[model samples]
Target: MVNEAQEYLADPVLGERVAAELRALLRDPNRLPVLVLATLWPVHWQRLTARRDPDAHAQARALLEEGTRIRVPDSFTAADAHVLAAEGSDPRLRRARECAVNGEITQYLAGVPVLLQRYEDATADARALLDAAIDARRLGWGVDLPTEFLADAASGYLTRAEWDEYGEQWPAPALADTDEHRGGFPGPLTRVRPRRRLRQTAPVDRPACRLADAVEQHGRRSRADTFPAETFWTASLAHADAPTLITLAESARIRGLYRTQMQLLATGALSNADAAAELVNPLTIPALGALGEVSRWAASIVPLTDPGPLARFLRTLHSANQKEAIEVVLARGPGRRAELSNRFGVADLVRRLYDWNHYGRFPESVRSAASAELAALLTRHPDGPTDTGDPKSLARFVNMLEAPAAACATATALRPRSQPDPDPSDAEADEAPETAMVLASRLKRLAEAGNDRALIDLLAEKPARRVAVSDPSGVAHLLRELTRIADTYDVDEVRQLSKRESVTLIADRRPLERVDLTDPTGVALLLGWLNRYHGHWTSWPDRFLHRLEHRRDPLYLSLRDQPYRNAEHLVWQWERAMLGRFATRAAEVALTDARGVADLLNTLSPRTFNYCPQPVAQAALARLLERNPAHHVPLVGASIDGSAAEVLIRALRDAGDPEAASHLQQRAFAAGAYPYLRRSEYRDYGLLPDGTWSPVWTWADMVPSY
Candidate 1:
């Protein structure tokens, strides 16, 4: 089709017709030549332009020359030359000529009339584009123009009414309710409001009087009605409520009004009935079944008054109950009849008893009641040598001795005398070992029962002294038994004793040489002790070094079996200590042994080496150089040698006739070697036989041996 067009254009008649058609289309203000040709022949615009006849080009040039003759603004029409710049059948050339000579030139020749006409045309075009955009937006088809085009067009054509209508019609989901149609309601419409459905009535009946009044009347008279008292008390205890009940209880207790105080105690409306009970219960005769409750009640009350009496009372009750309970078990005598005894002997019961007696005062009823029972037992048993002559019993007797009043008040009592020094000579005069053993056993039971003082007293006895000192297993067993005692219980003395014994045992037992070096726990304990006492003694270094060197064989064996294990850890510790004590020696060791050097170097982190001591740094560097000679020249050239090189120099000098020192110094001064170092200084400080500095041969004077 393109070839047919070209052939036709070559003929005069056909070419003339085609040229006339192109001219007609180009001259029309609304018709474009490219669009006209495209409609007639659906070929590429470039191909269509290339098919333009020679006659068409001549006609276009004539039209442009004619259009230019009409005077026009330079801005209104494209220059005449721009139309004919491209040759051949180019569509751009035709379009350019048409735009210049036709629409633009005609508008420019018409002057201000043309300007107003162009403005009106532009405004009409803008409005049409806006309407098209809005239609697309309404259909949910996105706008196609760039942001600038849309913004410019919208600015020129959008009106206030149009904007309002657009917003109302296209309200976002969140603002849909505020749209014009929704806002046209007669009254305000809230999306959320209280429900209007039938409300369910609560089933609970309302009281006749206010809760406070009802609580006050019914809460005070009966103990069983504690519910109302508890509820009312909680409500009344609020910071905003009146303190009538609290003030009444305080006033009643102060005036010695026992019945009034008891009434307040029964009321339970007060926040502190427990406090009131503690004060009042001791003065009342306790009911049989209520002894335990009454004693606890007294203890709770004691802190509110002089704690002395309450403390004494609580201790008395503890001693009495303990004795009665023990007696009850002993009377049953190691049989099924004593089954109830096991339940009462639990550690929890012992803790409770300890808290009650050791923490607070003795209850008067328990003290008074136990006094008679204790007196009867003492009268039957007496203070003479015990039947078993057991040491455990002697230890118990010693604990009993500390609280003389509790024991002396009994029917059997030790004779009182002037203070006398404890007789060491008369071992026989001391409590018999059998009795002491029995007492120690009982005291241990009491300690297990959480009675720290009883345990201490048992430990102080002659028989217990042997067990405590000579028996490591026995002491460990005892510590395990009392392990629950808090650190605050003055157990530091025992801990110190255990530490001393542990050290002795550790030192006496040789470390297992063939065992795992990965398990440094045994060695770690000794090292930890050394760290703990780092500054206490001067001899510790020798002792530590001796232990480390002696244990080296075992450590080595362990490391051999498990190279990837904590083998590095032990070597690190050894290196740290060596560096601390004999840094030079450590360096020598590292230089001699590759594995030891590697382990030591691994311990030295980059951060530590950043500010390491000059000698230490030099030692490390020398060792590294010896192990890896290739790294030596680059390391020196990098200027990281710093003080380490000087340290290495000094060390080599100290050793007579050092070859390594001479070799390094010679290399440093050689041509093209270590350019980073100062050559003049290197020559000035020459190597000596003793590796010391002596004014020696300069770099210029040295012969090239390499």
Candidate 2:
């Protein structure tokens, strides 16, 4: 029996092997009458069958189609619920019956939430092992985890405390025992086939076991479960063998973990053929640093029609002053361009080379080479149609390159055929726009009636095609109603109205001009909505920043009083704008006012800084340490609250001031405070200022030691 057949088939090597094994079984005349049952998620099955490489998976795809396929109902029937009700004597069964609306009972029947909670209670190393396995499987590394790989990777998950508890027999018996007896009860690991071997693996031999598919499925649905992002995981990956490292690198690339993938490829396990394959894969867009490294591995690989990575690699070389090397690469004859001659691929190569030719970051010599190369490439592949969405942008970029006439003609050919206008009836139905006044009026009436149910229903509906009302009065009225409702209600459903399109229309109208600058609450609400909708912390719209800077009084007021969500959201956005617009304001705020210091320190809190970049906070520290070590350092230290104290302690320890680091360590020991790498970090022993370590804070630390 094969469970999660789709998962097994995702691995290229494993899929071919499965195909071969099945063919052997079919041909055996002496084979016993047998049935093979396999389960597949429709989504994964669709993905596998739709793969572009038909020749590579021809046998596997054919075998899958030849079988008598059966799809189990994803949702439950009424009879199923009645059966659940009959078993209602079991509380879990009763709950499942109650919650099985629209046939989403699979979640309840499988007990996804309960399983996740139980998994959360497991030992850190156990959870780490399970997470790694799930990620590997999800990335097509195969469901059957090798025993040696798990054992080798387990040490990366251990903390200082777990290391001390388990000592040198670190991952062996500890891993097997933890998996078998989590919470002192029999766990999933105890149920693997040949359970006796699980208990009998000696201290010296490699441990062997596989997790149940049910547990892995539960882990997949969990929002919190992920492989450790710490450097330790990368260090562990470096130990992987050539085949494993190559598969793992491919997985990392698909997941957009480019840095991790780069580190994996740098292990020298990737052969020239594998490196060439990686470069040719459209999905494998290497980072600039990775492009340079991968270029070395791909030195002998044939150049294709696509020059994106190669062009980027050449730019890196040029930046590093490798002028002669750039010339050598540019002079290489294009080989095997036939396979990469697709219209989209050639167009992309043209665009990339064109970008390099016009970009100011490249040296003039390199830009000229890029332009010349692009002119030659276009001349060779001038027949394909180019369909650029933005003709003007394409024309501008092409016009700047060396071969303006040929480049412009290529871009013009790429322009898509003009689309016919939509049917009037369908167009009206699809894009029925509503005025902002009407949306705001409807929202205000819903709130005033205090019908939270109706309000939630309205917000849950698909938002209108557009908000016709962009006037300042209409936008303000809409925001005022949203803020008032938000202040009154504490539920998530009501707050979700903030995400709807009508709210976005207000920002589109530029309502900042008319908002009352005196009301900090209104300004805070406006800023929060704008920042949330803007999507990223680093990129605040210039207009939004200008408005805040124009009304500096309110910005300063919000900073002084800690206006919103314990200053978590509003103040965080305010500080981001401050950093963006006025570069030195962070240090000025930290050095001067006590309240500003608290706000600045608050930004360093783990919760806040998780979304925020490190340099923004580090800028303040760098300035504080440089200008006035004695006067301002004490003020900044005095303002450290418990919430933000962890970040400050870590900052001081890493701040390169021996005296400050020593003094901070002593104080942390006295206060039972320790700086950890992550918020989830806990260690038994913390290093001290005097080149020694002591036990970490715990219940035992509260009582006298024996």
Query: Top model by lDDT, which number?
Result: 2
Put down candidate 1 lDDT per residue, 509-528, tens digits, no spaces: 32211112232222222222
In order, the Cα lDDT scores of the candidates are 0.32, 0.47
- Per-prediction TM-score: 0.14, 0.36
lDDT of 2 by residue, 1-706 (tens): 9887765565554575576466445444467454567878754665455555213354466556656667788677889878767765987667776775676677657644444555677677666566655554443344455555665555556667876776477556645753565443445443234333455554433345556455666544441113333432354464455445656665444333444454555442233233344442333432242344344444434344345334434444444444454544555533223234344334445665666677646577766766666666655654422433344645644444434323322332111233555543233322433544456677777677777887787666644335544343345456566655645666767865643433343333334543433332233334334423333222323433344445554644555465455323553566454433222333433233323333334443334443334575456446645654223332222212332334444554455555654554433332223322232324323332222343343322321321
Error of 2 at 638 (Å): 44
* lDDT of candidate model 1 versus the reference: 0.32
* Lowest lDDT block of 10, candidate 2: 634-643
Question: Poorest 10 consecutive residues of model 1 by lDDT?
Answer: 206-215
